[model samples]
Target: MDIMDIARRKERPAHRVFSAGFYGGSWDHDVRSVLGKAPRGGADVGEVLSTIAAVEPHDTEAWPTAWIALGDRVGAVAARAAERGHRVSAARAHLRAANYLAVAVNALAGRTDAEDRLQAVFRRHRAEWDGFTAQSGWDVRVLDLPYGDGTMPGLLFRPDAAGSPRPTLVMVNGSDGSISGLWCEGAEGALERGYNVLLFDGPGQQSMLLDQGVVFRPDWEAVLTPVVDVLLGRDDTDPAAVVAYGISQGGYWLPRALAFEHRFAAAAVDGGVVDVSRSWWAHIPDSLRKAYDKGEKEKFDRDMALGFKLPGGKAAERTWAFRARPYGTRGYAETLDAVSAYSLTDALCARIETPLFVAAPHNEEFFPGQSQELAAAVPGAEPVEFTAAEGADRHCQPLARELTEQRVFDWMDERLGR
Candidate 1:
């Protein structure tokens, strides 16, 4: 059986998280055992981007991770692209790749260069978005509000006219999520089970990351209010009933947004995150510590030098490198520090008085302690913290459709009295 197959068949959360035993993400589990401090001189930029540029676009994982490492060391992979005569589009992509990496590496590590790289990526993409869009019908609209800059681009999906207003589920996508709004196994499963869905890139989400240079904010309510506003105005939407959900890193973003914009009648989440910085730092996994903490510059060199053999190796290596760096570490840390004062657990418990449903993998490797903390906060929240043995999938919902969608949405139906 394949690794995922074995993982699904087994009944352990640890098994689910370690299903990657078949993958190289473990850094062979030994390479990271080493420990030490970062070198003083830093990394080499030109060589890093040059190495990254050699990789293809579809290889999104590896490239970004390598870029993050390089950025942490030398910095300015974007500037390298510009210096190399990469076109405007390529330059922008390089920067976005860097942004993608920054996110992967977690917070900005309190570094200004990291923030600059991320902002540049977001800003450049926003400018490019001016003439390149394929949205149609009610799917694309201008949603303006009182926060930040007022007007923001948004896409809305309403229930088909064939039926009365249905329960609308607002999908608050997590960090740098896709702008295409294409449903993945993570969420498309929910749509099939009789739910009116509206997928949008709120502030600090993909749309903003790619344009507006607005990155994520501690106050996500600004985004949610306008979304609720637009939904209520739509004829096909049931203004009295709504459900909200966030995923991945979104566990934090979605709950915060719902806190102030408490229009949703219900809320849900998958593999959520709490204490973003700690979680981002911990994503490195216990296995990969040797090469990093032990200060094995040579092994580190191999990880970056080859830049292809690392985890997320086959995909956009440069982007993956970036994902491993500022985006994941630095940006994540910076934002975490900024929002450290706010508690998603507190936010949801106090503000989200509506019924809540939680779908979380008990043995989640990515973001641990978050679901438990959130579930613990609010009473009467249907906390289905499932283990792999008892019919739960990790990160995304890969369970029996009848369970994840039908049952979950059915609860929404019951709540809405539809």
Candidate 2:
């Protein structure tokens, strides 16, 4: 390619909040995600900015430590508020504390003591989340939805205790999102629109993975079917208006599930994903990919082990380990093969009869163009574009939650005749 060719292909930053690096760009997005929750009481802008100011750039340890400190302080304030009979203040503070601690949980990914720290911080975060749910002044039901001889943890939030049937919204989380994140993503907005909201931890999600040792599975229909069954059994749910929405990795799971489980009235994905493995394969070297493709698992594993020991490879190795854990595989080749099975085939897309909404955001960092591919493959599916001009570019529109939610729910309302 010539210089002019390269220049023509170059693009500008979507939203330049920070420079490029793990602690810079990635952390900036994470901070924006938390701040986006401020409108829904899941976060406090001042508290979030103050927490960011205390962290040192590129210091992995400092990232989690600072967030944890903020969470602890906020949690204490929440406890004091509750003691003083300020339920609304306590609920808001607890929600923010839960979100702050969730940030810490994500930062522990590449740490030496990640497993231990993850367990401790996750439990604390869940506690704060529970505290918020109890005091949020909503009619919330803590549920144990049946799934394959076990139960999936879930929360069903209703705007009131009128016991009348209402339109319902099932919110699915991404690979590593916290329960509080569901509120920021859709639950709070759904509630405001008078829709009953259901949030749960499927296999490989928060409670399922951390507490029950359940890992991710390619056939997500098995996971979502049980959720639909539970929703249908509730008298408070409008069977004709039960819809689903998913974000991030859920962009793949929900579509895959809709192919078989056709109970949903409508569905939406914040950035569609045609193949979950594409993101994983993007980081693997071509030589390693060749070995894996050739079924040389032993050779690939040996080469990967050596590569991890090279200078500057430790961080990458740690990131791989973190991402691979949900696949329930320790071997690099095995994890890659497992993730490869998550692709959506043309046949699968053709089987989906539900009305679907796909968010094709510009500058999608992970699954670029996959949203368009998914829309083309799925007959009658609507693909909406969220561009950089509206500050709603990038994977999932982390900083543009309100705009994303508005478009998605509006489409859903039109489809469900709400």
Candidate 3:
């Protein structure tokens, strides 16, 4: 979805952590990088306003980066307005930039010293964390699982439900964020519903990049199996009802996890890889098709490819640039190239007994007919395709969020006999 469209829909008064996802992926890194770039060219009021508008972070850390990026110019505007005694205009600009950035960049769990400061501002301003408020019945702990020569962090979020070890949802996070990503709308919803949610930051997830120095991998299920053992051993989770759900990148991930390990009770995958390369290409929207067709962009594709991986393949950095950026991977072309080996369509369909939920968007630019693609993969695999248009909110449909949540929980509930 267009970043501007998301900004208009949220209609919040300030920048905060909650809005970070609106910026797309990597609110922490993107805000810092974008803001760092804006000042060199910002000449007058218009430039400053435009610059602040450009960095669109997908989450909370964007706010501070927003302020810091144009802090001098913004302060100058405010100061000039103040001298004229137009305090209202100056305050409005400051507040608006700060407010949006609060939700844009990720300062809450970020490493910078400003994390605390930014959080305090958000708590003081935004009122409360709208996503997750319940005291975590189960704590979220990150575990480092050693792989071939490297490792990825596994995040286990235990449910606080008071019962004989409830079912566990090993939430494989998307490619962009780290394990803390369990804080998003879907994962948080699962946690609140009393399921033990295990968020994994396997290859390419934030923790792997920042902490473990790992990049994305196609053989993600390999990473998941070990973590599954950890979750199974927990006193709080029902070993037999271990269901796995993948969203976005997780879509590719959870399927591979299931493909390798048949133990999961059921699987619910949304907006996942119909076929790796095809779906990776699908991440790019229709708007950029013309530019790509014209061969005008290289950077965007390069970043995507660089970070993307195919099963049993390597994650190479993008070899070129793209005009319009895909939210998560910067290397569009490279990612797509790696995804070219993509053929999850057949893989997911192979298992009919595995109750699968495949959600499709009405207007996917790259991989149109995702649900159909997924459905094609799993012949009778409980397909949940919806004709959803890209909404005023973002790329993954918020409109689909509610229905998707209900159908998934209900389906899993039936399968697990909960």
lDDT of 2 by residue, 223-297 (tens): 899899988998999999999998988999999999999999999988799999999888779999899889999
Error of 3 at 96 (Å): 16
- Stretches of candidate 3 off by over 4 Å are 1-64, 67-138, 149-151, 161-163, 178-181, 279-337, 345-348, 351-353, 387-395
TM-score of each: 0.57, 0.94, 0.58
Q: What is the lDDT of residue 16 in candidate 2?
A: 41
Models ranked on lDDT:
2, 3, 1
| Count: clashes, candidate 1 | 70
> Which model is ahead, 2 or 3, in terms of TM-score?
2
The segments of candidate 1 whose C-alpha lies over 4 angstroms from its true place after superposition are: 1-22, 26-147, 159-164, 179-182, 185-194, 283-336, 339-342, 345-348, 398-403
Show the lowest summed lDDT stretch of 10 residues, model 3. Answer: 315-324
Best-performing candidate as measured by TM-score? 2
Worst window of 10 by summed lDDT in candidate 1: 32-41
Cα deviation at 224, candidate 3, in Å, is: 1.6
Q: Give the TM-score of candidate 3.
A: 0.58
Which portions of model 2 miss their true places by more than 4 Å?
Answer: 1-25
Candidate 3 whole-model C-alpha lDDT, 0 to 1: 0.52
lDDT of each: 0.49, 0.87, 0.52
